[model samples]
Target: MSTNERLRRRIPQQDRSRAMVERIIAAGHTVLLENGYEGASTNRIARTAGISPGSVYQYFPDKDAIVAEVVDRWTDALHARISCVFAEALDGPADQLSVRVVMGELLDALGENPRLLRVLIEELPRSPDSRLAAFERRMDDLLTVWLRFHLRGHDAPPVGAIAWMLVRTVENVAISYVLDRPPVERDIVADELTAMVTAYLRDISLP
Candidate 1:
């Protein structure tokens, strides 16, 4: 019997829907990590998920949809983690050192899953879909709100633009670290980026 057949029999019909969906997402992560975006196919993902191709269809309209959902979940998690980092460090001295501490913590949290980060930065653009843009904007908007709230007392640059720039800069740095010929030291990159950003923001936010 094939893997799909075995999985169908092993999973009860009542639990199949959610189980299959999770399986598809998990398989997507695996396939994208292993084979990359262009190489990851619906058939391969279904095989990895141990579900029939038809089962994958029942959950996701197509591969793009599956990838999009995965990216969305990833972005949400990243935003939440960054928010936590800022929260813990927000009340400390509002200086470059404090920013460095917070951003370094954030990068460490992010480094746990380099593959997913690579897929998100490199593949999402190739997908050429509007939903990805919306997702990116939503994350930026959330970060913007956090900056505005935390810097309420300071004369800061435009919150929305600052947030957007920070998010894109981080994304670029992360992609470079992930895809460089020789992987760059994430710690060094994060520190330099934090320092540069802190300096720029300080210029505009001086009391």
Candidate 2:
């Protein structure tokens, strides 16, 4: 249930073993979304995986163990996608970066696995601890580094504080927008967020 569990987690070494693990994870994802957490059991996952219930337990201690692996895989991919955007956007003059450019990359990241994201948002928190925590921490780590140097000695609010706000605000908007019905086009939302960020980065006076 806790993130630490993943550190010593079991992994399939042989190709056949790896394939079985993948199948089990895929089944877990499907069952978790379809049946909800309460209904997702090792036995059900094994049935969906075309494997035996003992086989499921051979790999994962319990259902949460399976869910933990699923979240780990997803969060790793999402982190890579977002980090790529940050590298490109922050490589040049950070000031030249528009909200459109930043937001587009971020939206693209969210576009990768909306369903898994929904599961993380809706279900994972029920556990005492979650892999989603790692994902959020990774975002904070990457964004904090970017913010500290992006402005290059320019005057601004505390890098830590504003970076926290930036990540939280953008995450809420991105996730909510994806889950909401018929929200405005991503570009318009990006523009609005860009405007807000630009203004907030300035002194008390706004022109």
Candidate 3:
């Protein structure tokens, strides 16, 4: 493990310890959503987690470490939620409808935790070396691979570029749709994003 990874937090070895870590991370996330990053302190998280401050400190060195854990969990949940989309898209026709379904589901996942998502979107870029940043970069690479297979055909637009663009589309839309005043309906935003990506892919992809 890298020094940074080790420094972020501890890995629970037993099932019981693992559950405690999950609870602590989940509580940390709740603090973030309810109080924002500035208000999410280790003591507050420990209180919310129903654990001793020493227990929280034993696992996570600081607030950033807890935040990193939350981001990692969120991204892992995202990966789980979308795994089927990739599988279905790659197994058969990877067309616009598949794209539409995936985009819609992706937004729905974001809707599940708008406040925390907002904090992550706003605060993550400040530290390029953060684990959250690494998770996002890995997402771009994964999306690139997904696009390569999903859009495989003659004259396919560069998957790398398109993947980057698609990732940005989700980020922008999530930030707006999740945080904007009277946020746009999830379906509406999803439909528009699906249409835009579909159009771009169709224009370059062979029939």
Per-prediction tally of clashes: 0, 0, 0
lDDT of 1 by residue, 18-107 (tens): 676778889988888898778888899999988799988776666766666677687677667766667555655557776777667666
Model 2, 161-190: lDDT tens digits are 767777788888988877663558877777
Decide which is better by TM-score, 1 or 3.
3
Considering every candidate listed, which one attains the maximal lDDT? Answer: 3
TM-score of each: 0.70, 0.83, 0.77
Superposed Cα deviation of residue 42, candidate 3 (Å) = 1.7
lDDT of 3: 0.75
TM-score winner between candidates 1 and 2? 2
What TM-score would you give candidate 3 relative to the actual structure?
A: 0.77
Worst 10 residues of 2 by lDDT: 198-207
Q: Give the TM-score of candidate 2.
A: 0.83
On TM-score, the leading prediction is 2
lDDT of all predictions, in order shown? 0.70, 0.73, 0.75
Question: How do these models rank on lDDT, best leading?
Answer: 3, 2, 1
Better of 1 and 2 by lDDT: 2
